[model samples]
Target: MASGSKWTYSQNKRFEDVLAEYAEDTPDRWHNVARAVGGGMTAEEAKWRYELLVKDVELIESGRVPFPKYGTPPGEAAAAKAAARTGRRG
Candidate 1:
């Protein structure tokens, strides 16, 4: 996480989305994510933020932390809604 500036929910969601699209663990991949994140974030900073979110997501999934109800983080709700509409699992 960037201690220099707090990341809002929307920013974190954007990071998660970009991370998913650029899935591979590579220097270039992090740079791509950073570009998507914008705000002059460097690849190193993006990587740090990503790792923090990954851990939080794992904790949430494992019931160590409550799933955030503030808003759907990224995939979960969107997929569920799409599945409901299509009458198929997302």
Candidate 2:
């Protein structure tokens, strides 16, 4: 995935857990969190993903959108496109 774009559930969960280990208001905290996430994640990417998650969660909680589950296509259109690419039936 691109930086400043989508984040997987595991990534987000790891970010949350790792974020708590840092002291309150630590400078360069996002860099540490990115390192903790591993897989060549950049600090800017981690910070952007975290902020995106917060906004998405807020929208979901407020009934603006449904909560997203891991590994599921965003919608039927996406699912159909994926199925076509994989030559699989939906």
lDDT of each: 0.81, 0.78
- Lowest summed lDDT window (length 10), candidate 2: 68-77
How close to the true structure is residue 16 of candidate 2, measured as C-alpha lDDT?
Answer: 82
Model 1: per-residue lDDT, tens digit, 1-90?
453687787886788888888978665997898888888889888878778878998999999999978876567888888899999984
Candidate 2 scores a C-alpha RMSD against the true structure in Å of 7.9
Model 2's TM-score against the true structure: 0.60
- CA error at residue 80 for candidate 1, angstroms: 18
Evaluated against the true structure, the overall lDDT of model 1 is: 0.81
Q: In candidate 2, how many Å is residue 83 off?
A: 34
The regions of model 2 sitting more than 4 angstroms off are 4-9, 69-90
Candidate 2: tens digits of C-alpha lDDT, residues 1-90: 467556666666677899788754988988888788887888888788778768988999999998766565357669889899999996
Q: Pick the candidate with the highest lDDT.
A: 1
The number of the candidate with the highest TM-score is 1
Q: Which residue segments of model 1 deviate by more than 4 Å? A: 1-4, 25-27, 71-90
- Residue pairs clashing, model 2: none
Collision count for each candidate, in order: 0, 0
